[model samples]
Target: MSAVTIRAARPEDAGTVLELTRALARFIKAEDWFLATLADVERDCFGEAPRYEAWLAEVKGASAGLATLFPTYSTFKAKPCLFVDSLYVDETARGYGVGKVLMRHICQLAVERGCVRVDLNVLNWNPARSFYTGLGMQETGELGMTITGPAMRSLAGLD
Candidate 1:
């Protein structure tokens, strides 16, 4: 096993991050669901007043995985939380502790940012359930919901 390093993702990393995102969508059988482009990633995550933050993981100088997240407030918990938008470890990097390394990095990051918890959404069928549980993450049992595209427009009276 070689040293694994996690670094803040830069605009130039948009392409690789986008590639990993495609891989993740395909792995979850939602290959056509993503409509984002590298420009979107670069603009939203690297532009002025960035909306999100990301970390790129590398093992022995090779891309290993990525973790993208944002800070949120937990009204109920009365503390800040780190909301993980995505955490994708390449299949080839599985069983090599890449996921664990990325997760630990997020944990330490949350602490440094004064966050009391971390939140993320995992597909029900994703096999990483055990991995997350092993890290002490548990299902919150809260139903997740969202409105997008036409639905979002209609809800906001923009349609």
Candidate 2:
């Protein structure tokens, strides 16, 4: 196995990030709901006042995985928390410890940033739940709710 190298994603990596993201969405059977574009990736990750940060994992100089995350405040802990928005490893890269490496890198970054914890939402049926649990992540037993599309617009009184 070639050594895996993880690094911060740059503008030129937008396409790679989007490709991996689409693959993930497809894996979860949510491709119909995956509306993100390459432009969105570039803008959100590399634009001024970046809303989030992205990291890429490469094995033998080939893209293997990617992680996108942002920081949030933990009012209860009185410290910041790192929320991993997405973590994915390509099919060809699975079983090679790429996901584990990416996750550990995220945790290391959280520690270096003085974050009190790391957070992420995983689908109930995702088999990766076991992988996450293996990394010491516990299921919160909380339901995730969302209101998007017209409902969100109406809630914001944009209609």
Off by over 4 Å in 1: none
- Colliding pairs, model 1: none
Query: Total clashing residue pairs per candidate?
Result: 0, 0
Worst 10 residues of 1 by lDDT: 143-152
* Cα lDDT tens digits for candidate 2, 5-45: 99999999889989989988998899999999988988888
CA RMSD for every model?
A: 1.2, 1.0
TM-score of each: 0.95, 0.96
Cα deviation of 15, candidate 2, in Å: 0.7
Q: Give every collision pair in model 2.
A: none
Report the number of the highest-TM-score candidate.
2
Residue by residue across 1-159, what tens digits does model 1's lDDT show?
687899999888889888988888888888889887988888888999899998989998888999999999989889999999889999888898898999999999999989999999998888998999998999999977877899899989998
User: Candidate 1, TM-score vs. the true structure?
Assistant: 0.95
